[model samples]
Target: MTGIKMAAAVCVALFLIMPTIAIKNHDVTEELSDVPFISAADAAHMQEYVAFDTREKDAYQKEHVQDALSVPPAECSECLFDALDIYREMNILVYGADDAATADAVELLLKNGFERVWG
Candidate 1:
Protein backbone atom coordinates (compact mmCIF):
# COMPACT_ATOMS: atom_id res chain seq x y z
CA MET A 1 0.00 0.00 0.00
CA THR A 2 2.85 2.44 0.80
CA GLY A 3 4.60 1.76 -2.49
CA ILE A 4 1.37 2.18 -4.42
CA LYS A 5 0.67 5.51 -2.72
CA MET A 6 4.17 6.79 -3.57
CA ALA A 7 3.78 5.77 -7.20
CA ALA A 8 0.40 7.48 -7.39
CA ALA A 9 1.81 10.65 -5.87
CA VAL A 10 4.65 10.71 -8.38
CA CYS A 11 2.22 10.21 -11.23
CA VAL A 12 0.05 13.06 -9.98
CA ALA A 13 3.04 15.36 -9.73
CA LEU A 14 4.16 14.54 -13.26
CA PHE A 15 0.66 15.16 -14.58
CA LEU A 16 0.53 18.55 -12.88
CA ILE A 17 3.96 19.64 -14.13
CA MET A 18 3.65 18.41 -17.72
CA PRO A 19 1.32 21.18 -18.89
CA THR A 20 3.57 23.86 -17.45
CA ILE A 21 6.55 22.44 -19.25
CA ALA A 22 4.62 22.34 -22.49
CA ILE A 23 3.43 25.92 -22.08
CA LYS A 24 6.94 27.19 -21.43
CA ASN A 25 8.26 25.34 -24.45
CA HIS A 26 5.57 26.87 -26.62
CA ASP A 27 6.42 30.38 -25.45
CA VAL A 28 10.10 29.80 -26.09
CA THR A 29 9.33 28.50 -29.56
CA GLU A 30 7.26 31.59 -30.41
CA GLU A 31 10.03 33.98 -29.44
CA LEU A 32 12.39 34.73 -32.33
CA SER A 33 10.49 32.24 -34.43
CA ASP A 34 11.13 34.11 -37.67
CA VAL A 35 14.22 36.09 -36.91
CA PRO A 36 17.76 34.91 -37.46
CA PHE A 37 19.70 35.39 -34.26
CA ILE A 38 23.42 35.09 -33.77
CA SER A 39 24.56 33.85 -30.41
CA ALA A 40 26.22 36.46 -28.21
CA ALA A 41 29.55 34.64 -28.44
CA ASP A 42 29.31 34.51 -32.21
CA ALA A 43 28.29 38.16 -32.44
CA ALA A 44 31.27 39.15 -30.34
CA HIS A 45 33.51 37.42 -32.85
CA MET A 46 32.17 39.33 -35.86
CA GLN A 47 34.88 41.25 -37.61
CA GLU A 48 34.34 44.88 -38.65
CA TYR A 49 30.67 44.64 -37.73
CA VAL A 50 28.22 47.36 -36.73
CA ALA A 51 25.33 46.67 -34.37
CA PHE A 52 22.09 48.60 -34.76
CA ASP A 53 19.41 48.74 -32.09
CA THR A 54 16.07 48.98 -33.91
CA ARG A 55 13.85 49.67 -30.95
CA GLU A 56 12.25 52.99 -30.07
CA LYS A 57 14.49 55.95 -29.28
CA ASP A 58 13.65 55.79 -25.57
CA ALA A 59 14.33 52.08 -25.26
CA TYR A 60 17.53 52.43 -27.23
CA GLN A 61 18.75 55.33 -25.12
CA LYS A 62 18.00 53.36 -21.97
CA GLU A 63 20.01 50.29 -22.97
CA HIS A 64 21.62 49.00 -26.11
CA VAL A 65 24.64 47.16 -27.41
CA GLN A 66 27.81 49.06 -26.70
CA ASP A 67 28.52 51.43 -29.61
CA ALA A 68 25.37 50.33 -31.39
CA LEU A 69 23.55 52.84 -33.58
CA SER A 70 20.07 53.76 -32.39
CA VAL A 71 18.06 53.13 -35.51
CA PRO A 72 14.43 53.31 -34.53
CA PRO A 73 12.14 50.90 -36.38
CA ALA A 74 9.71 53.70 -37.18
CA GLU A 75 12.15 55.32 -39.56
CA CYS A 76 11.35 55.35 -43.26
CA SER A 77 13.09 52.81 -45.45
CA GLU A 78 14.57 55.49 -47.62
CA CYS A 79 15.92 57.33 -44.62
CA LEU A 80 17.38 54.15 -43.21
CA PHE A 81 19.06 53.35 -46.50
CA ASP A 82 20.47 56.85 -46.71
CA ALA A 83 21.77 56.77 -43.14
CA LEU A 84 23.45 53.40 -43.63
CA ASP A 85 24.65 54.04 -47.17
CA ILE A 86 28.21 54.47 -46.00
CA TYR A 87 28.18 51.11 -44.26
CA ARG A 88 27.12 49.19 -47.35
CA GLU A 89 30.28 47.12 -47.44
CA MET A 90 30.32 46.36 -43.72
CA ASN A 91 28.49 43.71 -41.73
CA ILE A 92 25.24 45.08 -40.24
CA LEU A 93 23.61 43.35 -37.31
CA VAL A 94 20.22 44.60 -36.12
CA TYR A 95 18.23 43.80 -32.98
CA GLY A 96 14.77 44.91 -31.81
CA ALA A 97 11.55 43.66 -30.19
CA ASP A 98 10.36 41.49 -33.10
CA ASP A 99 9.88 40.99 -36.83
CA ALA A 100 7.83 44.15 -37.27
CA ALA A 101 10.83 46.10 -36.18
CA THR A 102 14.25 44.45 -36.29
CA ALA A 103 13.48 41.87 -38.93
CA ASP A 104 11.83 44.53 -41.08
CA ALA A 105 14.91 46.69 -40.81
CA VAL A 106 17.07 43.81 -41.92
CA GLU A 107 14.78 43.23 -44.85
CA LEU A 108 14.84 46.88 -45.81
CA LEU A 109 18.62 46.96 -45.71
CA LEU A 110 18.81 43.91 -47.92
CA LYS A 111 16.25 45.33 -50.33
CA ASN A 112 18.14 48.59 -50.59
CA GLY A 113 21.34 46.74 -51.60
CA PHE A 114 23.06 46.65 -48.25
CA GLU A 115 24.93 43.39 -48.15
CA ARG A 116 25.74 41.28 -45.06
CA VAL A 117 22.61 42.23 -43.10
CA TRP A 118 21.37 40.10 -40.21
CA GLY A 119 19.13 40.17 -37.11
Candidate 2:
Protein backbone atom coordinates (compact mmCIF):
# COMPACT_ATOMS: atom_id res chain seq x y z
CA MET A 1 0.00 0.00 0.00
CA THR A 2 2.81 2.44 0.91
CA GLY A 3 4.67 1.80 -2.36
CA ILE A 4 1.47 2.21 -4.36
CA LYS A 5 0.70 5.57 -2.70
CA MET A 6 4.22 6.81 -3.35
CA ALA A 7 4.02 5.82 -7.00
CA ALA A 8 0.65 7.53 -7.39
CA ALA A 9 1.92 10.73 -5.75
CA VAL A 10 4.94 10.78 -8.04
CA CYS A 11 2.74 10.26 -11.07
CA VAL A 12 0.41 13.08 -10.05
CA ALA A 13 3.33 15.50 -9.53
CA LEU A 14 4.81 14.69 -12.91
CA PHE A 15 1.43 15.02 -14.66
CA LEU A 16 1.02 18.54 -13.24
CA ILE A 17 4.61 19.62 -13.87
CA MET A 18 5.19 18.21 -17.34
CA PRO A 19 2.70 20.47 -19.10
CA THR A 20 4.11 23.56 -17.46
CA ILE A 21 7.63 22.57 -18.49
CA ALA A 22 6.55 21.81 -22.03
CA ILE A 23 4.68 25.09 -22.37
CA LYS A 24 7.64 27.11 -21.10
CA ASN A 25 10.02 25.32 -23.47
CA HIS A 26 7.66 25.82 -26.38
CA ASP A 27 7.33 29.52 -25.66
CA VAL A 28 11.10 29.94 -25.66
CA THR A 29 11.34 28.24 -29.05
CA GLU A 30 8.52 30.36 -30.49
CA GLU A 31 10.07 33.55 -29.20
CA LEU A 32 13.36 32.75 -30.92
CA SER A 33 11.77 31.78 -34.21
CA ASP A 34 11.51 35.43 -35.18
CA VAL A 35 15.28 35.94 -34.97
CA PRO A 36 16.74 34.90 -38.27
CA PHE A 37 20.04 33.21 -39.06
CA ILE A 38 22.10 34.90 -41.77
CA SER A 39 24.93 33.23 -43.54
CA ALA A 40 28.42 34.77 -43.42
CA ALA A 41 28.13 35.58 -47.11
CA ASP A 42 24.78 37.29 -46.62
CA ALA A 43 26.11 39.30 -43.71
CA ALA A 44 29.07 40.44 -45.75
CA HIS A 45 26.75 41.77 -48.42
CA MET A 46 25.08 44.09 -45.96
CA GLN A 47 26.29 47.66 -46.28
CA GLU A 48 26.67 47.97 -42.56
CA TYR A 49 26.15 45.75 -39.53
CA VAL A 50 27.35 45.86 -35.97
CA ALA A 51 29.26 42.62 -35.42
CA PHE A 52 28.44 41.36 -31.96
CA ASP A 53 30.82 38.73 -30.59
CA THR A 54 29.64 36.37 -27.86
CA ARG A 55 32.90 34.43 -27.69
CA GLU A 56 35.29 34.46 -24.78
CA LYS A 57 37.73 37.36 -24.56
CA ASP A 58 40.67 35.22 -25.59
CA ALA A 59 38.90 33.68 -28.57
CA TYR A 60 37.62 37.07 -29.69
CA GLN A 61 41.05 38.65 -29.39
CA LYS A 62 42.68 35.87 -31.37
CA GLU A 63 40.29 35.88 -34.30
CA HIS A 64 36.82 37.28 -35.00
CA VAL A 65 34.97 39.14 -37.69
CA GLN A 66 36.52 42.51 -38.29
CA ASP A 67 35.17 45.21 -35.98
CA ALA A 68 33.24 42.76 -33.78
CA LEU A 69 32.56 44.13 -30.30
CA SER A 70 33.21 41.55 -27.61
CA VAL A 71 30.05 41.20 -25.54
CA PRO A 72 31.07 37.91 -23.92
CA PRO A 73 28.35 35.41 -22.92
CA ALA A 74 24.65 35.83 -22.17
CA GLU A 75 25.20 34.81 -18.55
CA CYS A 76 26.31 38.38 -17.98
CA SER A 77 23.06 40.12 -18.91
CA GLU A 78 24.00 43.55 -17.58
CA CYS A 79 27.27 43.54 -19.47
CA LEU A 80 25.62 42.56 -22.73
CA PHE A 81 22.97 45.31 -22.38
CA ASP A 82 25.54 47.95 -21.47
CA ALA A 83 27.81 47.06 -24.38
CA LEU A 84 25.01 46.76 -26.93
CA ASP A 85 22.48 49.39 -25.79
CA ILE A 86 23.94 52.11 -27.96
CA TYR A 87 23.75 49.94 -31.08
CA ARG A 88 20.07 49.03 -30.65
CA GLU A 89 19.11 50.83 -33.83
CA MET A 90 21.78 49.20 -35.95
CA ASN A 91 21.60 45.74 -37.54
CA ILE A 92 23.59 43.28 -35.43
CA LEU A 93 25.41 40.14 -36.56
CA VAL A 94 26.12 37.82 -33.66
CA TYR A 95 28.67 34.97 -33.71
CA GLY A 96 29.92 32.58 -31.09
CA ALA A 97 31.78 29.26 -30.75
CA ASP A 98 28.55 27.26 -31.09
CA ASP A 99 24.91 27.60 -32.14
CA ALA A 100 23.61 27.43 -28.58
CA ALA A 101 25.90 30.23 -27.47
CA THR A 102 24.92 32.42 -30.39
CA ALA A 103 21.20 31.68 -29.91
CA ASP A 104 21.38 32.67 -26.26
CA ALA A 105 22.99 35.96 -27.16
CA VAL A 106 20.47 36.55 -29.92
CA GLU A 107 17.59 35.81 -27.56
CA LEU A 108 18.95 38.26 -25.02
CA LEU A 109 19.32 40.91 -27.71
CA LEU A 110 15.76 40.41 -28.96
CA LYS A 111 14.33 40.53 -25.45
CA ASN A 112 16.16 43.81 -24.88
CA GLY A 113 14.38 45.50 -27.81
CA PHE A 114 17.05 44.98 -30.44
CA GLU A 115 14.92 44.60 -33.55
CA ARG A 116 17.63 43.82 -36.11
CA VAL A 117 19.62 40.88 -34.79
CA TRP A 118 20.93 37.83 -36.58
CA GLY A 119 23.06 34.81 -35.67
lDDT of 2 by residue, 1-119 (tens): 35344334333432332222221234446544555666543444565567677889987788655456888874457775886678988888776776567678888788888999877
List TM-score per model, in order: 0.64, 0.65
* TM-score of candidate 2 on Cα atoms, chains taken together: 0.65
lDDT tens digits, residues 1-119, model 1?
A: 35344334333432332222221134434543544544443444555677677778887777655566878767755876787788889977676765446557777677788778766
**Each model's lDDT:** 0.59, 0.62
Instruction: Point to the candidate with the largest lDDT.
Output: 2
